[model samples]
Target: MGSAMNPPSMSEAKPALSRRRGRIQLLLIVLGVVGPMLLATGMYKLQFWVPEGRSYHGELIGNGQTRADLGVQADEQRWQILVTAPKDCAVDCQQLVYLARQIQISLGREAGRASHALAAAQPLSADYAARLDREYPQLQRYPLDAGVFARTTGDKAVPQLWIVDPHGNLVLRYEPNVKGKDLLNDLRHLLKLSNIG
Candidate 1:
């Protein structure tokens, strides 16, 4: 009778202890998954579509003063396409010039909605310059300012195109190797629905 009233031995307690430990282990596994997922959601919300850190690259030109010299006139609405090329263009360099022209033509009837610029690259052949002027006179030519050019060009390569909308916002950057029709499609989308200043 005394032995019967005594507490159970360690061996007898093992199953209950194991069950309790398993419940705690399961709870920890759940928390490990849930804790990191909640953190990731919060971080994504803060990164994009918010104006937290929108400092621009390159010298932000024509921010205050309106310029007619670049044909980016205050009154005329156009998308300014700027390209960075070396002082003397190699084979890859000529393709970029051709690329800019094709992008404009690819705009088709909406071609007037955009313009191009060669930043820092040297002058072209008389025929080439004349042809560009004839075909897309809105395209401006500027010697690339070394300082601004460096800022926009990153580790891999220089950004091929930086487009400023009519209201003068740097909104789009297309990679250097982009095809003309693809960029034109993007431009068409921009031009269609937008009537805002």
Candidate 2:
């Protein structure tokens, strides 16, 4: 037909290439718009139902014993709050104890769903056990031997609260002088937020 159309000119070839590039750009835009929404949904599910990933080098006490030897293995399976206090509890120590007791009680319907126990950096005195029986009938204070102290922080450093999750993993440990409200808030927060193993 007119000398075979003299082949399409190079100048005209660029427009066809530009149109193909435009189609690629449009496809990329669509993918970019949809990607974030899908990612967010996945992350939301990941936030819950995750297995216990708690990895903490528990304070190296000399003789840290597990709940098994103490016959508390079953209790440990539940969401348990474990605290180590000194053999001779001071005023501040008593304050933490009181705060912990309130926190356990505040669990209300979830109280049984969780277990809280106290370990003495030193041996538990008869008086301490009696007091626990009187005030916190539900809580049982046990004598954590010296090796346990070595496995933990150390001797003479006491009254620190360690939170153990339902999956028997040590999750959070609080420092000294933390307030009652702060502890209660943390306990509530952890209980509400995590449904881990």
Candidate 3:
């Protein structure tokens, strides 16, 4: 009866303390592994802590669409500034094409990692074709399928420029009136952040 009433011996208490310590260590390990995943899931689902301002000037293509969705057959392995002309390459389209070329050239040392391209729904006029040939020898060209382009873009008729990744994923898109300086800044930021082309 006295033995039962007395405090637990040190030898007996050690195992109990060790078991408690082991349980705490195990709990910590579990939390360390699971905590981040839970937090990330919560943040994503709840859309909390997201900033309102965007670092990029162009509209982001978050739908995971690729250049193929635009109906242009391009196999470029580097980053591309693709100007899409769903109609004839009119003045606005021509300006965007010129801007695309200038943007690539302005990239300076990083220019080799990127290329400029034009995809037109209709063939350029003979005079404009000759001019592009003479003036923009490095310009890559593709034929834009009007039907496919129409399906993809709905009724939007305005020509636009796209920043495509090395893997052909569409990134940012700019309207016809986008400034060259703003586009240049966006490309520089993308190049700085990207490891791939």
Question: Which candidate, 1 or 2, has the higher TM-score?
Answer: 2
For all candidates, the clash counts are 1, 16, 0
lDDT of 3 by residue, 1-197 (tens): 97876467867899999999999999999999999899899889999976799889999998999999999999999999999999999999999989999999999999999999999999899999999999999999999988888888885688999999999999999999999999999999999999997
TM-score of each: 0.52, 0.61, 0.78
List the lowest-lDDT window of 10 residues for candidate 2.
Answer: 54-63
Structure candidate 1, residue pairs in collision: 120-144
Determine which window of 10 residues in candidate 3 has minimal summed lDDT: 2-11
Ranking by lDDT: 3, 2, 1
The best candidate by TM-score is 3
Name the runs in model 2 displaced over 4 angstroms: 1-20, 23-75, 154-156
Residues 1-197 of candidate 1: C-alpha lDDT, one tens digit per residue: 86776366766789889999999999999989998887777778766433454333323344442223222223436776656564454445556767877777777787777776765445566876677688756667766544444443442234356566776566566666766666666667767867742
Residue 26 deviation, candidate 2, in Å? 7.2
Listed per candidate, the RMSD to the true structure in angstroms reads 10.2, 8.5, 3.9
Arrange candidates, best TM-score first: 3, 2, 1
The candidate with the higher TM-score, 1 or 3, is 3
